[model samples]
Target chain A: MISSSRFLPRVSGLALFLFLVVPAPSLVPARAADPAEIRIGYLHLAESKQQPISLLDEPTDDDGIAGARMAVEDNNGTGRFTNQHFSIEDMRLKPSDDAAAAAKSLIDKGILLIVVDLPPGMVLTAADAGRASGATLFDAGSSDDSLREEDCRANVIHTAPTRSMLADALAQYLAWKRWQRWLLVTGSHPQDALYADALKRAAKRFGSTIVEERIFKDTGGARRTDTGIVQTQRQMPVFTQNAPAYDVLVAADESNVFAGYLPYRTWDARPVAGSAGLVPTSWDPAHDSWGAVQMQNRFIKLAHRRMKAIDMQAWTAVRMIGEGATRTQSADPAKIVAYIKSPSFEIAAFKGQKLTLRDWNLQLRQPILLSDGRTVVSVSPQEGYLHQTSELDTLGYDRPETKCKLN
Target chain B: MQAQLIRRGRIRRWPPLWLSLALTVGATSSAFAYTAYVTNERDNTVSVVDLDKMQTVKTIQVGQRPRGIVISPDGKFLYICAGDDDIVQIVDTKSQQVVGDLPSGPDPELLALNKTGDLLYLSNENDALVTIIDVKERKALAQIPVGVEPEGMGVSPDGKIVVNTSETTNMAHFIDTDKRDVVANVLVDARPRYAEWKSDGSEVWVSAEVGGTVSVIDPVKHVVTKKITFSVPGLRSEAIQPVGIRFTKDGKLAFVALGPANRVAVVNAQTHEVEKYLLVGQRVWQLAFTPDQKYLISTNGVSNDISVIDVADLKVIKSIQVGSFPWGVAISPE
Candidate 1:
């Protein structure tokens, strides 16, 4: 019982099938050539933190991955015309996982273009792991100035605004508003300390004077309690009391320690800015100009949450890759990276400008949005802040100040 | 620096009927009149500007968010896209009132009409669909899915092709009219908001609002043949966002409205070069040419006014306050 008839192909049957199918392939040679497939990896560290103000303000489960997916969809839509297809591999690593090892695993899986949503150290580790193979890593999470300075890597392209850029954006706007004197308040955390340094540098650059510097020491208290608001209201005003009069109060609380308690709770009527109140960010929920509403609406419908600054950073990184692929008509990671680094490469992230990568540091140049948690108050590099190359460059560390070797 | 151009031509106060008739024939043809219509986005009204008088004659209240507008081929009716109302209101220009509504999709941002005026191609910006409706039937015949956030509609001169530009997808989706199906898609720069085809239909120009470039594409090959870049001495490159493009009667000159830069880039159409940037109102959004091609009106959104430019000299002749946000403009052919 070998079932000999099943294995046996009749001469007439085989000839008829070949006759119809073989000519079809010959008739359309273009169809025989498959579309160029671009594979991207999104690497994020699995972590969570207590959102200070509202429970609803926390990052969603998808978070950075959702942005990558949207960018892939956007790229695929544009890619279909050029006979290119885009696919993303999302890999989230635990706190204990090694970023370098995880990056290697993704490389083994045939992903050379990676969007990293990791801490600065992990982003560096991931970049180091991929550099030997000419892999490109887009840093969407960290805003450390050192990543674009002493610790810069040729393989890493930064999409997130650096601490210097954010600080300068606020400083320029504050200068425009004639708030030239600042009462600088910084948290005790290392990240906050870095932000404080950037703010100081910005103040010096913009001719703004820091009247006094106060460090808000973190005492490790519960963020949300029945009596927490009462305690915070009493503590903040007293802490800000008896300070010399300043035009504005600028905070450097990147660690989410106490900046949120400064607005309206200050001892004086002066406004709070810089990491809180009127903060400078890559993207905000209230931004709706220059065709941003469409982006916001699409993101809301897809992710069921408002897109955050980190999400926009991740979105921008993936879009940079997508823009490169669509423009160059290539799926090769090296070609994409080269095109991105070239002066001709520009990507628009609904920022009312064509964002380009800086040749020296590979940092994307974009306008920073100053938001008051409700609406975009202003955008900087404000009117008078001019630059030799681009006004956007005026907000960040320009070419002359670069310590980056890009090796 | 001037508030407006002061070109006071001698007024022939109350010319005789015979002399005026002769002058009208000389200016236009037998008995034609030119009327420029501007859609006011925030006020939900269409301001009817009289070219003969150089002022707004009447303001017809349309509905919520009236942006894209176009006059019929015979110049009897005007189609206005009231975006929030989700209906394309048909207004009888003579009556100065909405006569009916075209069955448009979810959100119609822009509309394109064929040569015969038999079909209307509408771009549903929110839904990513292009609805083609029969003008006579007043019903949609085809709802073709296009790229994301379709905002610009361009119908080829031959009436064989319709090109729709999507903002988010950064593409021009080409639909073959006979089949009413998408035949090809061409990738353009980011946030393409408007598209215009040459008179001969050989090529199409698409304006990218965010990419800050205008891509001229070959209709046959569906590829960008030339990319036009603009530069004004003090204007930031990012602010030179191209939108609302228009070409002259002979196709020798093209006028591109540069958003936020507040200038209209006068381009040499044949060479694909920017000849000059004429300063206009803030956030210039759309452009319209009078039938005689002697003047061009640009809708300035941020300034809430329209700058009328003398086409021959590329100078701003007059700035007329229209409404809160003037987004789209159209003119009736004399």
Candidate 2:
């Protein structure tokens, strides 16, 4: 209790230690600031907004989400040098949700790259919002060419195959199969009219003639019920009873309101093609040749689901980002954008040629595959329709016909 | 009597235990001694082989689409190119674990390590560029533009020359390692894939997958010097497409894996003559040789078995079952 000398020394030592430990924070030079992270946004249509068609299943979240995830993973996987990492923030819009507001929220989150799946109007609105945010938009849903034509935006890139490209692919195959005369059935919608326009253009390019044109109204009714098939059977045959004497019935039913019933029971007993019977797509699960099996396996393992054309498009878009990052060794958006637009660059998506983006419209030039519901029937560019630049340009808008000006 | 009995029992037990210990040590040292790493494409696993016993002892899971594998020159690490994952996975040879991943180009299919083990040349097939990676830093230093679908790659004997073969373009691009740029694009036959430089570095041999022949190109002149074609009775010319080509240590004998022909053609390098055709399993894709050059292993992709050929006799020795669709093969230098 009376160890005063020892207690005094201990107190003196504690004071010395405190004096040494305090202050001098300036010597450390605040830990170097972390690198800026790159964020990408994804927008898709909610399940309720998709037309209630029963011929095929509606696209799930995995279709768009998995692709964006793959793109991010691939980008970061190869973006190590540039210290760039891609993050996806997805916003799914319901039937009544404001698409522009949803896009604005994504932009607020520092997401400057967007992959969108929406209808034409919603896509245009999102693009307008994206432009204000200085974000780059990749449209993976809409096939309307007007988005790339009259309404073309400098900030947007169209990843979805155009309606004209799909129609041309189908028309080329039909022409090859000697189904020269087409009974064109147009639906009562703007989207259907666009598809019909593409079909007519393809028919002219491939030496096929439209024998007659008919209109199918969007008569609203219960699409899904236990008795839907019986009702469709009773209504279809009578509706198409007086069709023109054509080789095939090319139905322009993008909304799938009535074309699914046109096959096998057509008025002329001819085959049905387009939107319902034989459609053109970028990818199909049944395709197993040309190293597709490997890609399919990788997709299944990564996403835990089967791949669709939309997923493939997303994957390609993401892969393109990775390619740019890896090649430039820089994550600066300007550098990456430059590398992507460079003519020397090409990316292999397991298709025959390395794909490159068009300078004017930013659309990827690719060979389209014509598929029946079950399997791939043929691939287009059809041997003879040659282009001075690339054969793939023959399917879509060529250089001479382009209305896109980047400025 | 008690002392003698105790001494004898101790003596009897001592020798036996010592003998058992010695035998155990000997067998253990011989069994799991050398590590042989195999890249599995679909399973995403690298199977380690026990060289002494000649069997796969352990399987280690790795990144997606691990295709090319090469043990470091110092034999301390294994660099595996995971194509789908788009990185070169570095595995520590000592601990048999993935230590780090090196940044390569997008979709690296094949890789060739420099002699000093400091630089790695990776073939990024998707982007059509050869990404030069600094192995120690695990960073891509430069990307040299090449032809389309650049898959097969190899380094010259002196390590001064790098050759990349593009399948679709049918051209073998010769690159100067010092400059890190393409020096020449020698026109080859259709589907020029898989190139192998001679030990002396005088010429480079490339396999033409669709041409069914191997073009011997003079690297100095940058032209094809001669073409070697294979013909067999009852076999279509298209089926005899050549893929992997390798030469013996002395450079006197060359073996080419003729895909779909189910055979490996042994050629006299000097004479440019086919010595013999060793029958193998179906769809032979690649080959590897034991260190002593006494045994040759050919991977039959479709059959999923490795055909073992006795080098001396140039005949099929045995076939060992492996994983489904075994592609590339390499032997442990140790």
Candidate 3:
């Protein structure tokens, strides 16, 4: 642990002196080539909102960080052959903690790659701080479209699927099922409104119509109490009673306040989709195709829990660092970032395909898994949904739809 | 079929991977009692299938997780990797029974034989080692350290350089037999599980099960020259994972087992163009051709059967039921 700033110069001199005194052998190339110590930093929110799901679906303390750690283990497994060693530093910030201060602390320790698992506001602050320090930032949690759109940071890459991507995935599946009419219900949260905007954009792009838009107001009440289920059972059906006829009820509840209660309690007896019944995500626990069982089993053994999309996103962000280092055979962040932004960069994340980054917004191009909580129903970028370049382009904002001018 | 093979470039070499392939082709010319050995991974048994009759004559119980299978150069014995038991079991082809065992390290998954047949190379998947055993002494020789989860082994025809493909590392490590050390590491796609040398020995093809592509490497240069892609209609592109690869005797054609797409891609070896996709059983893992070149058998892991394809017409002639999760396949010239 070279902690003292004054001793760093002496250690450098000693390293130079040792290099001159000793002749390095050629037999062991692994030692000769491996001089780089690639370190990554993970910044996440210390206090997150309690997600209301079944007891089996509760989040863990190391939700995003655990996935980043698992990816470091995976990277080290392959780093042995690539002649590189990887390490990750995890920093958690309180709700009142300044994200830029945490970013500065990580940068002070010589971390050039940082994985940010925070809300949209915090993601911006960290990205700004990381950019000034010549560090590359990966957004592993924020799904807000503006981060990849008008407010896109030049140094930030997104492994998390945008709201537009998720909405597009759901819209494509709905259109494929000939469910053109949708009864849209959105929560009153700001994030929920942003998700609704993307859902509207998807409906327009994919030839679907929102029959009516209804806002589910956040009447002040605690939902985790024992008497909440009975209240939800009576209130939801009556709330949805007077809606127009529609094929499916699409919910945009990013706040998780009401979507989980809409499935079996709908008044129209229609299948509920979008963020609830059949959700479009980067990964699901039931995803067991294309040799994903191996990855899932590996995760279960390590984390002793089911892998969520956040975990996969964080894992991918760190694995990208390892992949870039291995490909370029250098620990330089500039070189790694350049190689990652190139057209030839790709990494397999048990998604049944090699995922590439859209050179336009640096968003990862991946197929979305539409899982129904228990089993994977199907994957999006569905059959007939085609694009001029890649079918995966149809599931997200394409190159032509970008206003992001990264300076 | 019009094979649209695009040749990237011709690799030059003298007497390449063909020495063993040439012998395999020559052995097929005679009416030898050619037998095909299939390793049933989940069943922990070895199925001795008669190629002429296209049937399993006997099922010999081996250790747990019997995967990689290879016939001895003399054509009398068969060597297999029983992964969970951490040992390599030898089977007498004539008697169709487990005859002996080799001192392999932990979790042996795949094996290969040198041209001289004096040594056997087996991959210890869990330990990331390539264990070499001297056949004459029946003793362990050396354990060469490699990348993580090394699963495939392919020895050069000249018995000089041995190739070990690591699953997690996604690299083809070339080890020099003389020094018993890794000479070079060539990065392939994700989860490279198997490697096969071209008949002329100019190139080595490695299959990446998760990357859904095959990397063709120049053995001398130790770099991937071309990446082979596949397109099967109605099959999701991600499902076209190439696992086990085998080239025909004349080096004109190749067969790649697509793990879950339930198909095998037949390609023109020279041009690297996919000629056809032959629909087979579910989760086809590995493939082997009879010495007579009359039939090609594929082990379907999920369906627990072997699909027999007539090599002449490239059609599935029959699907024979086997034990659960049939994995590696090796044909005998006895």
Candidate 4:
């Protein structure tokens, strides 16, 4: 079956043109038609030049796109039985490149499914550019809550978890552990402030009390100095002294300023939680239960690195597209998108449960893993917190709390 | 065994399980003892539990990551799918030692045996192929490609058809035993883990762990006839993931293992309705029934124990602690 399709490309120009222009569907049997080709576009912005705290924390060059590539292989494995084929066209945009123009070019090539790894602004730009073409966008990068709340788009589905979801997951675990009092530390960056805002909201929702709040200003200095921990060892304890008594120290450090240096440097001897210690994330390398070992092994063989959160989000987005195609059994994007948004649509991504899309805001519902860098400490939406619809709904903005009115 | 009794004109054919139970009561002065072999996926060991003793008798070291297990027809040997080793290990029941190995394909997560126990079907999860092996010869007959991530295998009652459920493809492929090709494909819900056929061969029930439902498929028409859904109060629907399924020999009752919900659903096989939910250990994976139909046992993955249920009363009678991450179970015939 594959040889016949491969043989068609080797024909002469006139023979191929005639084969293409002959309108052969009427003459040939339905089963003998070529496999339906489903092309997916992966649009990602170039990585920023910020250095990770540890040298071991550096990312691979194909961080998110490698996962999408592996999913394409998995899709083709399943597509053999369904008579369909899948391919991905990846586009990496530079700092000055227009994301909208990049998205339009993908749409011009007849790609209907686009997975975007971009910031919140660039995601919105690409989503708007594809809206008129009836192209669906999957947000695999941005975690800003506004993308799923006030700025939600009908054509864009978010596979990434929002900051509020991560914050709530951590707060729920803390509440379950009876650590009700938190000393919140905020970095001076804007993203850190937004994370701090989310943590405050979570603390209120989960009945935890923030005893005190402090700000750690980012001074103008190189992040990686020659005398790194020797200086940090003395500076951190003095900066954290004289805080109110708290069960835990929650650090909202999205800017990579100081969270990693706070675990053993706190003055009050409290465990750190938000960005460094016991961090909440969608996926982690230490997660091996619930058939995840198969996925981890396959990914390691593909990428030659441990799978990260972004890799998992990208993998899930592409797998969702593959699942939509298999269920509809057609290459039609309209049917596939409609099926994905329906009540019955669910995809299993080795998360020990099925992940479904929220009908109101187009966010994927999933469990958040709390990791301490070595192993998964726990998964959140902790024991007693319940929701009428799904236990996962308890971790993020519920239906009643969502401000999204999709267009 | 029951077929021999009916052939001797000792009992009626219908409701054979109950008649066999009654005969066991009249024939034995004490309760009949049956042995259960459970595969612990994490610890890579098999815990042997004596049903009458209601405790683990012995723990035997096996190959890496043992998950699926089955017993021979004459109750002489046990076949275990050592997934990481990628071979099916054969152990003698009486001697409790590894006797031999079958050439299963890569990553055999589940297996099924024909009534005569000569042919073995393995779902090689990583390879996406169903490998059929001749047990006595210990050679692979054929490796037939099915779907991606095949995890469940069920052979039809008459041994004419084999059903394999692929998790990622979310479909059940029915393969003809003689031709060894997929004759029909029936789409079901997501992440189907296990398949069970009715003794009368009227319907096949497939449990989808992620979709949280059991789709009842008609083997003849190759279509879903009905779906069984489970609900426990105060628990989310996603938490009620159905993995392993088993039905009574009389086909009146069905036991579905609900993973992470920490409960086992008792469903009416005839009506396809969930009758009751019995609370068990955390993350229940697979189930089995003793040969006499006296007890039902479940392997709880997270809690690392087995919950024993009285079949007649539908109550959890005993909880036996086993090795870590106990996943699959098989009981020996007395």
Candidate 5:
């Protein structure tokens, strides 16, 4: 009985679709009486061998797409009474595939709302390709600050937090805890360098001092060898030895190099934060407060696993489209995009408050969660750190500092 | 047990002549206070607070995760929605003990009672159904399907209609009592958490926790007539989540519990304008009124305390510490 009631709406929708497809005039309704159909596209890169250091952090095959599917189901739940129906088309691109071509193919099929989980360069290519088609793309993967700044695209909406936002969230908690001195350890990768720059900016902005800086080269080694635990236990302490006095050791290893080995393996008795210990993220599996338990449970039930940060970003992006369509009561892509860009567009993804789009940068302004792999330590945009307009704006770049100028 | 219930109901209806005359003659205005029962969601207990004493007098344990609470019209029993247990436990007010349990559906979050208080209506959050149970018979008469994540239930003053608010669906479903089915669904703001009807039955107000607005709907037309937004000078708009709403006896003022804002907004019901905000404990979740309408109490979930508001003066007078995570409250008529 439970499963039947749950599927009844879709059954009726399918029946209606069949009725409308038939050539019989008596079964067809007037144009104004027909339900509005909304279709969304999800484009994500195929699975890669680059996984997190921890075995428990492996990404599921349906990670980002699963979240989009959940939002589509949620949208249909509301659409049943509103005379609307939502569907999603998912496309997985290989490493060598052209993102622009994949996006254009989806746009050609009348799916004007696209959610992209790709690298920064690929996101720009897909956005540019969809520009002529008037398709709106949601960025749900990349955290590169340049994507929201100098390299920003006019048609792209970013649900993923920038590196600056994550760094600032961690910095604010550290400042609140009165950990004013940081010993910064950066990886050799280019993405790691960008994250390190964001951390430096946050340290200066939040009145913290980086006492000393060190580098941890990747050196091309296997991440999970039999002797890994013993080697890291002895090597990490010596590598981090004799640094200038600091309250905390902040890591900038976005490439999953060495941050995970710094918690108990540090030479000094200090806490670790940044990309590993007490990391900042958009969502965590342990988050249960603020009515998030239901959302977590629903996602787990659908995906058969715990939700991840990327999943949450994809979910928010799809939910934004759903909110826009439901509010405007129109499936026209132009109208939906306009409504989403307006100041009235606010969506609640169990974040304790409604999240709105930053009109200037098109970034989703949200509170970042600080987690320690097991449970949520705290949420950012902490108390007493106020902005003139919004506390969420205090984390990322404000309007005055924006390098983005939408055409 | 039936005879005992009847005798207990009759004695409460009419006080002894000598006691009534003594109460009327001595401190008539000052001593008119009632007992407030609060359900602590985290502790799985209810704290019995005496209004006159301004403190918790006793604690009665119940089932797991008790949230929504309501008192009978005769003030003889209290119905507690134990969400985890999936049953509504009945507590005899006189003994302050669990007497029976009603067959509520899964994950009951909030509930409503009819005007005569014989029928109970509760929203099953997990099943998306409004299970209407016969209170005296302790059986579910009907389970009416509704939108997703139905959390709030409100009945009309005339007992003809009951409204259930679905959080995810963002709608207020009006269910006909006689027919036991949804008559109309009014789209409201996002994440609608609570529904309240005016005493005159003209408007039904639904509070949206995420959309941060209260939509006032015309019951006859089943359309939203007005959307009331809240704003505080220092707080951001998102933090001003309006949850539980209560109206005064005269229907002039309305008190809305602003969750996480740590305040209660007093709105002019006639003009639909916010008059003032009264600061209270942290994460105020629900509210209840004293029988005499002299004081209003708010449950602070985060602070684990109840703040008492002097209704006429519009001031927070006292805060009484209760069990952990005090979520729902109901006061006796006496």
Candidate 6:
């Protein structure tokens, strides 16, 4: 009897050990620390010799550097687990500084992700430099579609909404509003020709006819004199007189020298759009609905200023990384990249729909909010332009037509 | 002499019996009669604390972003609103697994279960609608339109009245549950958030986010009774904006979580007076109380910690680190 009792106690102890030692089915595997740290570098471009008429002359925080900083802050806040740290080594390229050398410097700093705010030629050089370093470049400022088209590199993600997308958004809205006849005003610069080309394509797609086309030359003049407004008031009307009998004035001034004066005192009391009035932007501060207020408030508190569209895009990119890291519980770059590309993954950017990246051009597909400097007029793909897959694909270049072939 | 002898005999026999009975009753009463279940939002779990033991006995995982938890009237289930999931997850009190989900509106932030346990009012912020769901049927019955960015919903003591606050619009819409219509819209202040009705349904207090004041509104009159403001040293007025407010069961004392001030303000309900500010974790958003009212748990969103306040002393006893961005707290009745 004593032997039997001792045996029974030993059997119970074995059972208890089994119960304690065996892992529960609900217990998750412990996450391993990631070895690599993903770093992103940023570059900014501002015009040399502060020309008052140039858009780049404004010493504003509304640029790629500010956007990169916001992205870095957000990434570090929630992206620490993923071992992804964004560092901005901003080199403002002068007319003299070698853009390629700057790109090489950023690459040498171990920054695999590069966001550049530069013109098309400089962007191409930087892209080539980035290719040499095996770094992925994201154009946050430039609207030139050619960079993503003819000069597309294997390691470039175009975060900047293309000129085609902007034109299409505007065209659809104008077509819907029954503004079929457009008076296209092209600027003198080559940049203006590119925008004009996009505008012409937009007109073709939306079945709108360009009634008249005029070239607005950059007349050499002082911008901010005490008597400049009065002089401009007199000069602009003559410059804009007897142009066309169209419904709207579509200005393509990439350099905002002349278009800033074409809004109210247009030739035929027509509404101005395309680069000035009723502009299509990725994000606007007036956008407070759909939980955007919280994001806006947080941004303002963190940055001590208003957030621009570029800043919002950068913020979204970093937020996407953070979301992926948190959800996957691993910061492995490959895993994070895979998660971001998955169709099931959708991120809430305080925008109405969950934003997803287009696999074709590597551009973020987002609804373009049309603003007139004050209020949001409308959001586009104007009603009936349906896509075979996602509605957002209609905003940018579709998959079948994309020239971006990632090597 | 005969009477005295009889009394002494009776006393000797009764003393032992009465003493034994008294000891039995005392021991039973001293045992824990209640337990507090605290829903930790970040942990995505619930902590069950035995009041007598003063320690957590069990922790059970629930759904994502679980907030606004309440025990069923029958005490058979615990209903938790998983905000991100957009459903009211029902947990069986015995098994503790999320057994089912109720058809709540999209992005349901706050919830209030009616006294009968038949209805649940959910503030669907995204849709700007208050969804009424039949608890037993687990289906949404009606979606009533409210003001912009509706959040922080509560049912009045009578259960007939429901109050929902629109954060951006700075107004509280009082809805008659039976009629399923808005009875009154009372304008409070800038970004009026988190409404709590008085126990008697005589008053409804709403926290103003940007205005840094709590507006006390008379429910019957649907007018502002008074506004209680807070001014603390070295703190900006805008930073002292109130977010969460809770009153004692007797409605004597109230606790208001001041955002960015890193403190909870204790106020005398009757006097509408700010008594003292108990320092807590940063950016305190919501709070819950133990059933015995011995402890108050406040969720500090930015700090990612739950500050436990000792009720008697009105001081922070402990700051327990939890999950990331802890937004809500619900302590089960002790």
Best by TM-score: 5
Question: What would the per-residue lDDT of candidate 2 be over residues B110-143, giving only the tens digit for each residue?
Answer: 8888778888888876555777777876655556
- CA lDDT scores, all candidates in order: 0.84, 0.73, 0.83, 0.87, 0.87, 0.70
Backbone clash numbers for all candidates listed = 0, 0, 3, 0, 0, 2
Error of 5 at A207 (Å): 1.2
Answer with 1 or 6, whichever has the higher TM-score: 1
> Which has the better DockQ: candidate 2, or candidate 6?
2
Off by over 4 Å in 4: A1-30, B1-31
Candidate 5: regions farther than 4 A off: A1-34, B1-33
**Quick one: how many clashes does candidate 6 have?**
2
Chain A TM per candidate, in order of listing: 0.91, 0.85, 0.91, 0.91, 0.92, 0.83
> Interface RMSD values for the candidates, listed in order?
16.1, 23.2, 13.1, 11.4, 9.5, 23.3
| Runs of candidate 2 exceeding 4 Å displacement | A1-36, A49-52, A80-83, B1-334
lDDT of 4 by residue, B157-194 (tens): 99999999998778898888887778778888988999
Is model 3 an incorrect, acceptable, medium or high docking prediction? incorrect
Looking at model 3 chain B, which ten-residue stretch has the lowest summed lDDT? Answer: B5-14
Residues A1-407, model 4: lDDT tens digits: 11123224334455546545654222112467788999999999777677777777775689899889888978887777678899999999986789899999999999989999998888888899999999999999889999999999999999999999999999999999999999999999989999999999999999999999999999857778888879999998998899988999999998888898999999888899998998999999989877787788778978989999999999999888888898899899888899899987899988778899999999999999999999999998787887777789988788999999998
Off by over 4 Å in 6: A1-37, A46-57, A80-87, A320-345, B1-334
Task: For model 5, name the residue pairs that clash.
Answer: none
DockQ of each: 0.26, 0.03, 0.23, 0.26, 0.26, 0.01
**Model 5 agreement with the true structure over A124-219: per-residue lDDT tens digits:** 999999999898899999998888889888899999999999999999999999998999999999999999999999999999999998999999
lDDT of 1: 0.84
Between candidates 3 and 4, which one is better according to TM-score? 4
Model no. 3, DockQ: 0.23
